[model samples]
Target: MATTNVREITIALRSDGEGLLNSLVDELSRLAQEAVNFMKRTAPKWRSTLTNSIRADKISDFEWDIGPGVEYAPAVEEGRAPGKGLPRWEDPAAADIVQWLATKVFAGRRRARRTSMKAVHENLELRDRYQGLAWHVRHHGIKAHPFAAPTLDMMERSFPARLELAARRYLATTGSGGAA
Candidate 1:
């Protein structure tokens, strides 16, 4: 659902000349790769989760996908309302500690002797200690920290000159006389 809301940037070039197409494709691919690098560098450093999930794949000789794969990537990019996103454990080790305390220390007490394992698991106090921290974070959602948009902005500022330069180099190297 989050991915459906993802913003995409498409760069296209139309050339009528026959031999210029291959040069354009190569230049576009290079530009896409450069943009992907820019996005990855600009991505937030929190847990590096979003950054690590970023990918850039050439859909065709002309297109690329440059974004994160994680489901929450868009949520992080776009922000979310309080209580809207999935809860993420702040400390998995702490949850294990809480489970141990519930099953070992508390379960050994006389009053807890009559309690079933299911009842112990369902104990509100134990559940709260284990899950409450995560819930609290999700209840107040994180603010958006956009990476893709800024990367696109940077690319837009420089891509024309970069493309033109690449085209010039390609033509000069290939000794092509046609218009690019």
Candidate 2:
């Protein structure tokens, strides 16, 4: 089975005492959320499926997740093998044709009755349609378009500035002028 991949960033803070921990965690969470938002914008905007699936949440006082439980997200981020990344149809249209044929053409037929030529023709038509869809899918499989790694790269470049800003804001609010 395909699995979702999680990527995280860790930030460490040096504080003077226990009083600063809660404020630090809160500031870090806000920063992490900002990073996740940046990542979402950086994500490839095809069907917007993967991009929309991006999420951010705090895992602990010090840990945060930018993506979770997003199956197929890794495939979009890192690329996948041919025929491996396409979403499965919940109710395939081709399957519906087959089901209709079974119900309308074969449902009332007795063991002694042969299928009429019209039924055979309809079956062939449905088969052709199914084959065409299959052919298109097989020929054009999911192509890998990485988004996460590049987003992370960009974040790494700017994180120091962001962290500094967050720290400054924390200091301003707490009035702890360079103490912790």
Candidate 3:
């Protein structure tokens, strides 16, 4: 629910545009799902939690929200600024960092086959290493991954065409010729 990188677009409708949203609901839902999938694809695949948290929700009659469900979503998307203190939740032996270290540092090794990070987490030597890495992160801010931004850019570029398509579909369904 900690949404970030929020983008809003408003559509102006004619005075008598009653039920126009109903006609386009399916198309809009599809668009929202597409955006979620795009975000999932673009998100960094460290342990896959962030990517998996991506989802779409209908907030109002004409509003849809597509974003991640995790608390760290914003941090992952926008990154932390340099010199920002480590989050209170993240300690040196945090399961996530340990898992990431297992996945990254010893890639292609036997340890990679294990899913649980219990072994890595309990290892004192690895804990020290993760602590060092965490310390470094505190000093140097993480770079923005920009999954949401790119999706917004893609949506901006394709929105006009998509709206036209939806409008044409609606008009065709209602058999309304361009008389106005």
User: Clashes in model 3: which pairs?
Assistant: none
TM-score of candidate 2 relative to the true fold: 0.52
Best by lDDT: 3
Q: What are the lDDT figures for the candidates, one per model?
A: 0.65, 0.59, 0.71
Q: Kindly give the stretch of ten consecutive residues in candidate 2 with the minimal lDDT sum.
A: 4-13
lDDT (tens digit, per residue) of candidate 1 on 26-115: 788888878878888888765677788888888887678878888766766787677653433345645543554466546655544336
Give the number of colliding residue pairs in candidate 2.
0
Best by TM-score: 3
In terms of lDDT, which candidate is stronger, 2 or 3? 3
Worst 10 residues of 3 by lDDT: 4-13
How many residue pairs in model 1 have overlapping backbones?
A: 0
Clashing pairs in 1: none
For residues 46-112, what per-residue lDDT tens digits would candidate 2 score against the true structure? 5566677788766888877776346767856665444532223334734543554455445665423
In the range 1-180, model 3's lDDT, one tens digit per residue, is 564322211121352256456656777788888999999999998778889989999997668988888888888778888785443335553667677775766677554223566555546556577767767788887778889999999988986688667766665555443121
